[model samples]
Target: MSFGDIRVAERADWLIERVATAGTLVLRKLGETRAGEKSVHRFLSSPYVSVERIVETLAARTALQCTGRRILAIQDTSEINFAGRDKKRRGFGPAGDGKTPGFFIHPVIAIDVESEAVVGLVDAEIWTRAAGRVTSRRSRAIEDKESARWLSGCQAAASVLSDAAEVTMVADRESDIYLLFARKPERLNLIVRAGQDRSLADEGLLSMALAGAQPLRSSVVRVAPRGPGDKGREAIVELRAGTVRLVRPATVRKSEAPEDVELTLVEAREVNTPPGKTPLLWRLLTTHSVTCAAEAENIVQLYRLRWRIEQVFRALKSDGLALDDSQVIDAERMFNLTAIALAGAIRTIQLVDARDGGPRPASDVIDANFTVALERLSKKLEGKTLRQKNPHPLGSLAFVAWIAARLGGWNCYYKPPGPKTMRDGWNRLAATLEGYALATQHENPGIP
Candidate 1:
């Protein structure tokens, strides 16, 4: 809907408040208060209430937070599988099982490189594949393809973060497109995993070039457990760095021909993997120069922060937002709901990330009532021992997080709580605040 419409603005504000307060609950539950069920439905069904507008608003807020900082625009794609619904459902395509129907979402999230805090979502695109559509990869232009999302994401990030000191476009192997590198903006740099064994300027493949480089450094890195079947472990990894010039692929048309792109490649391989454990191997390509082991390690660390986007996806999925469980059938309505959910997911991560470090004020994220409720909760959650008491300054994000973590059952001895724990804590705290608000309203009937 157009921003000029007062109804659209009112609905947008309501949706944002609902998302921030209630989180991933179904619409009936979210709008159960003042607006009622019909209002919620009308809000979602409104043509002026759009996914792009919602995303743009949130992205602008994110960009404001990123002022004067070196931000990492971490981009990645995840499928929203709505498989097993009624076969007559209209707006979906082949998903996980190929027979099931769903769509894909590609998002670029800006992160503070120094603090590793999730700044905000820079941009997001949602689309479904055309039914019965198939095109030869070599013949189609990049502009007409889905893979162009990577380049577009980079461009969007560059534009949004123009005032920042620097913007590094970080991605996984899936984003290692030749055109992305050749046409990358001067203001933007890249740190993507190498997916192709391309021909180098010195007549050698990328893999061979990396394999020939001598190890420059060694360090131990923690590897998070991937699944229930595996255990988290630490491994000693060796780093190697090299520079290579990537040649243009023959598949790219003459008119679209791009100059050879020179990139610094760094490989981090585990020196000794435990029995039954897979060794860590990451070959990273970057436009940033790496002359020393410290510089290479910095690049590796930046790439590691790419996991933040994965956390966002997890927040949107079953573990957090439960987006796949959404009952919306129409594509437009679903996209609008997903946009709201996306904003909620980012806020969830922001709270979790703000727990330990950073000087962000709690008021910037949490409402005064929520913060007051958490403040009341802090006294009860803290222990007699000084160390067990809330260590963060009052009115700070860390202070609220500390209380939430305690309410979520963190004993203060284990590692800091992740997003799931914080989510549980926030849900409980929200319920408490709701009850408190009701009691306050009853005590003073005429209060506005």
Candidate 2:
């Protein structure tokens, strides 16, 4: 089940072709296409799709492909914002900040952390709304940016992921409520982070039982505040071993007031903060029975993998695809655009894994190989005179040739080192080395 062996050099090409056709097209058209950053934006957005699918597929495939190891299904969601001038602005309302306009894209992504690959993506719908008082479901849906759509999306993902074996749903505090937990349609497991005001009388009793058996010790870990606006505030909380029931704050519904639910709390935190700061510690609840400290730690770590979704966000933006700068108008177009960007982020993960080396072959290696081939071709035919005309022999055009030449097994001749040529030559040499590695993978697929 490990990525230790498996030659997918051929598969790399297939993935790359997919990215080129669907993934890249959506990213470039999303936004900033007219700014001459089309290529840059395209590159940034192509990886999300590949990575998400790869991780999900790998996790499912591994469970089926391997007999001993079980697959862990991880699901989490985050918000994607849009600007006023964005094409989707008409669809977007005030995004809580009042100054900016945006809509949210909620992706309930499932990944196999053990294998470090994305298994499935739930990039269907998003729900967004501005903060206000007297929120009702009908009124909220009207004002809701994308929540109804997001709900449907989450429901569909639940149906699809119900089939995953040994699947565990790990999410942040937002998903720790009854709406998501109480009615799981599939054979799914959940371990959600608890909210501060969650009613935990039952959990408190159980915690007291466990606490009576063993002494509670204080452990401190510093955590940075959540959200985009909050900066530089770090909270150091004292951790104690205890249990608490998780309850969602009740929404006033006509004649009905509110209700609470019970969940096991294993470890509770007592936050130390200055005045005006809210005290919070996770009233963690899980379907899986946590017996020992190690088991509790495992659950905590699994929840931590929720952060991988953030990495997925970065891959959508800083890595190569800028999801924030999207220009797609209308909700449907924006969703499609987001899907494409997700695909791009997935592809980026594959690219990194391929170059860094993983179980399956990545197109990045092929890219590296082709790049070297063109450099060699430029050297043989154009020679030193070409270098004089364009000192950077491996210009963008040469890179394309390098890809073709390496695939064709063209050899690169060594150019005599000159003072001005060393840096670029060294770079080319590195490219050649990468090309050689890639070519070797194709030539001897089983060697790894």
Candidate 3:
């Protein structure tokens, strides 16, 4: 079956409304009226709309935008637990905590490597674990375990980003699986942090090999802020790079997989750390070659983009959309709503990314109907000077971002606007667009 045009319009309107409301999952706030709320509920509860189809629609859009770009397929898993409301929830099993009623969402978001702009969602893995005692890792295959998300994510990236010049699958330590390397998709690159000390093909330990290698160089790296009022700090880190052969663990169930895989290892060990704080260490394994310090640093920098997924989590959870506070009692509807909220969270982040001028088009986050209104709003915000005026071209993501930041109350006097300011500005813009459209239709019945 295909997604109907009416369904597309409804979802598009929902995306706009969701961002305007800071990703709230409540139907009451999203609908704003009894009829409106019921419509939203019906949309989510519709038997015709499945989670897979919803995600596939978004993936198709992402594929179109990623053509001829170096794409980063960043994947991460986040839990959505209903805490005390687990009892009332139906169709939900034990969450990560083993008791809460919720499911997990593992989503891969495509980002333009050069522009640092969001492309769109590629795939999402949403599932609920059955209530039972789990088998040991050695007894279960990667396919049967939660760890298969990495391989699935890579395959999805390869299929969706086939037109891209280059594609790299990046993730944290939990993704350091041998099957991922042994059975990687064609032309798909990987950058995963090592999680455990494994045997090397040369009869040596993996950690000792990197530690024994000479330091490549040192550089300063920015640490992300922990929360509000906490400006993150930077630290000087020593770099080390080497190529090592990794032996497949005996515990792995896939006997047909390769016995050994050769990959470069890049390590960044922080020096002169602040008191009471542990030093930062990153053991990155990648398919790309790194023979020089510059190449090693490049790999490290790319891995830093993994933080984007972390920000997405913040937006989807307590900071932006409070999915846990959702009033939905059915697990299926909640899962469907989660997919939309995930996209909305990314949309909010995209606006934040464009607060300054950027290369992405505004269509990345808004439809064409709002372009004229955005232009009029831009005129109202622009001053007489170049610095006072918008720096990005019209119809660009950055152009729309400047309007959002200004509407959010940035004076062009202080630090650039953050996520909160961007979301607030977007909220105001959404309201303004609705009012403008209504007023336009009222005064001129022919204008749509």
Candidate 4:
């Protein structure tokens, strides 16, 4: 949290201060003075402000926010590609595209399942593959591959949310690793989309386990778009759930691996195709017990929440921060900037989510000192009638959002404010807080 030194702390604070506003990640643009710009560059290049330190700071916040909540620890990996800039960049390796030069980010974000609001970040692993031909998977162990992050993600959620009432780690297909399920802590639960047609102890394929299972229920699901600009479609899918014992593969190098691991399988298969559109089918495997239709539906609902990370990714790239537009070419500095940009993107999404009037507290996103000031600002925005007043409780995140939407010029008559409006309002609110702090410091000397 100290960032190793007073100067380092100051520099890191400055970066977080402006980045949290959901603005651009450009250093000079974000800086108030020439020295502030240089400070940001130095902070990213400093060995003290490493990725581990920043993640630790985020995890500490997560631990405090996650207490007594049922958590959906959503884990995901995204690639940051710098294809044509390979010549100018240093200390970099191949991206997922293999030909391009870039790196990968695997993040685990915590969400309170009951309130369905983001709690905080549990962990993030940032790394790159060495340049050259990759080794064959058949000859390598799980620890020697990028897939190890899945296991580490589980470990992180366990340690960070030790006091949480319940923890269920959710992931997409890439996390369907046998070792992960076998070695997962007993205290932690798992829900990963099945990618492999793994063998079963019953001498059957995992893909066939639910083929003949009776339909427990049906529901409509939103299908994601095929491309960047296209709107997604909706589909009606039938749900089915069953249990199976997965047999460990012969190629598994872990001698301690169990012969079989029991897990529940939940399937949501599309009922009918609308023509030309892709069908919606999800084969989810989990450690949570499923005995009824309502219980199986809960699993499907939680797995759908994985899309929240995709929204953060969109905000981090094309929609909000545009991290690729940054001019920093050095790989080390880029990595640090990536970490800051990610925090900014996630916070931006949190504020946008708050705009809809959730039950989340104001302190979830703002400092306690700012709440009193926010209350004062809230009063100034109210109109004559009670209908014009903010409907949310005084200390909630929705209260802050109402103030922000008002600052962004929302009439409170149309549909709720969008992300751009929320971002504009949030920045305005942040600038007002800065002005308030400066004004009060002269009188109280150290009040903030």
Give the clash count for model 3: 0
List where candidate 4 sits over 4 angstroms from the true fold: 85-87, 222-234, 254-256, 382-388, 442-447
Query: Is 1 or 4 the stronger prediction by lDDT?
Result: 4
- The digit string of per-residue lDDT tens for model 2 on 1-448 reads 1222232323322333333222233434322236534543433334332333433443343344323323344444555666545542655655646546665655656566566555335443444455454455644521142333333444555555554455666666666545555455455567777544444445443334345545243444334435555543544433333444444434423332134544445564545567977764554677766656555656655665676566566566643455566565554445545554555565444333222223432222234334444456455544344333223334342343233332233333453322112222323443454556677776745432
Task: Encode model 1's per-residue lDDT on 1-448: one tens digit a residue.
Answer: 2466788777776666566556664888777766566787887888677878877887888888888999999999999887666355578777756667887889999998888888888999988787785889887889989899999999999999998889999999999899999889889999999998888878888888877678999977777667545557887899999888988888886568565778899998998799988899889999999999999998888888887898888888877888887877877788888887888888888889877857777876766655555677788888988869999987888888887677677888768887777776776776676677777776644422
Clashing pairs in 1: 1-48, 1-49
RMSD of each: 3.1, 11.8, 2.4, 2.1
Can you tell me which runs of candidate 2 are displaced by over 4 Å? Answer: 1-80, 84-90, 127-154, 201-262, 268-281, 353-448
Q: Write the candidate numbers in order of decreasing lDDT.
A: 4, 3, 1, 2
TM-scores for all predictions: 0.91, 0.55, 0.93, 0.94
Report the lDDT tens digits of candidate 3 across residue range 102-178.
89999999988997777788999888889889888777777888999989999999998899999999999989998
Rank list by TM-score: 4, 3, 1, 2
TM-score-better candidate, 3 vs 4: 4
Which pairs of residues clash in candidate 4, taking residues 3 or more apart in a chain or in different chains? none
How high is the lDDT of residue 327 in model 3?
83
Total clashing residue pairs per candidate?
2, 46, 0, 0
What alpha-carbon RMSD in Å does predicted model 4 have with respect to the real structure?
2.1
Q: 294 in model 4: Cα distance from truth in Å? A: 0.7
